[model samples]
Target: MSRKTGTLLCLIAGSMMLIIGCSKSSEDRLTTPIPPSDCDTVNMTYSSDVQPILEANCYSCHGNGNVNGGVTLDSYTGVKLVADNGLLIGVITHAPGYPPMPDGGGKLSDCDINKIKDWINRGASNN
Candidate 1:
């Protein structure tokens, strides 16, 4: 074959190989069912169970009086206020009219969300 024809054939073969290699990988996709929340055993008033979850997930904006949606989850009373008003449960559960918590992205795990729900169901006490 002439030099120009040989180079053209090689370019076509390289482009085909590139296309096949770029196809999506089956293993990278998610295909499992997510479990529902388990809130029956969570205690809202206990600092051990509740504080860390709040500090890590909520404090960034809820702290220092920078409450985002007219609600605060900083102290016991603040958390209780939202809980008593049913806003906490509504947002965490992503009910139709309310947006999910942490507004930026990923939601709290089902377990954590359930714990908050359980706390609210139990009257959202400060104790």
Candidate 2:
């Protein structure tokens, strides 16, 4: 082929490959499972399940010296207060009329929410 024709063919081939490579849907491109979280919602406990989630997601704003919205989650009694008043579920689940919690941190994972709900359903025990 002539030099110009050959260059044109190569550019066309490269463009086709680029288009095909970029056309894949995100899921199709991702071979590994997204996050692969194991959600165990059974037999939830305060020390093991609930408290840790609160510590990670809530304590920054609602624990220790910082008590936003007059809520403190540093103690079981404080946590229980919200749990009893339905504020725990309402805020975490981002239900209307209840402010979504963790504030700027966004909503908790579905697994974490389920664990908290299960704990509440089981009487929001101290255990």
Candidate 3:
């Protein structure tokens, strides 16, 4: 192809790609995500939502009968004690006068933190 013709074809292809990219649906273009159903924190439950998160995150030092700092998170009653005393929120959120939990690990994801917070706010029930 002639150089000018080749260049014109390239430009046309690029323009079409640009148009396609900008034409994405609003859902596709969302600045804030539609929260995933996988992380459903709504009306958070202790056994289903809260406990799993703790089992994955907190159980290392506080589960399987491994009690650290007098905190045991392997079961509902243990978790309730921490939740009632405000230690759950304080430590997870790294509030002043409370030790940062996970000890050596990074802070829990905001979603996990929110889930625990929601569970705590919802009376920290065993159910």
Instruction: Give the winner by lDDT.
Output: 2
Model 1 bad stretches (over 4 Å): 1-44
lDDT of 1 by residue, 8-112 (tens): 999999998877666444333444444554444556554656656777887887876778877677788787777777787787677888978777767887777
Cα RMSD for candidates in order:
8.7, 6.0, 5.3
Better candidate by TM-score, 1 or 2 = 2
If both were scored by lDDT, which would come out higher, candidate 1 or candidate 3? 3
Question: For residues 7-97, what per-residue lDDT tens digits would candidate 3 score against the true structure?
Answer: 9999999999888878765547687666666766779999888998899998989998789998999988899998999999999999999
lDDT of 2 by residue, 24-112 (tens): 66548686567645788989999899999999999999987789999999899999999999999999999999988879777998999
Better of 1 and 2 by lDDT: 2
Candidate 1 local distance difference test against the native? 0.72
Q: How many backbone clashes does candidate 2 have?
A: 0
lDDT of 2: 0.92
* TM-score, structure 2 vs. true: 0.71
Name the runs in model 2 displaced over 4 angstroms: 1-37
Q: What C-alpha lDDT does candidate 3 achieve relative to the native structure? A: 0.89
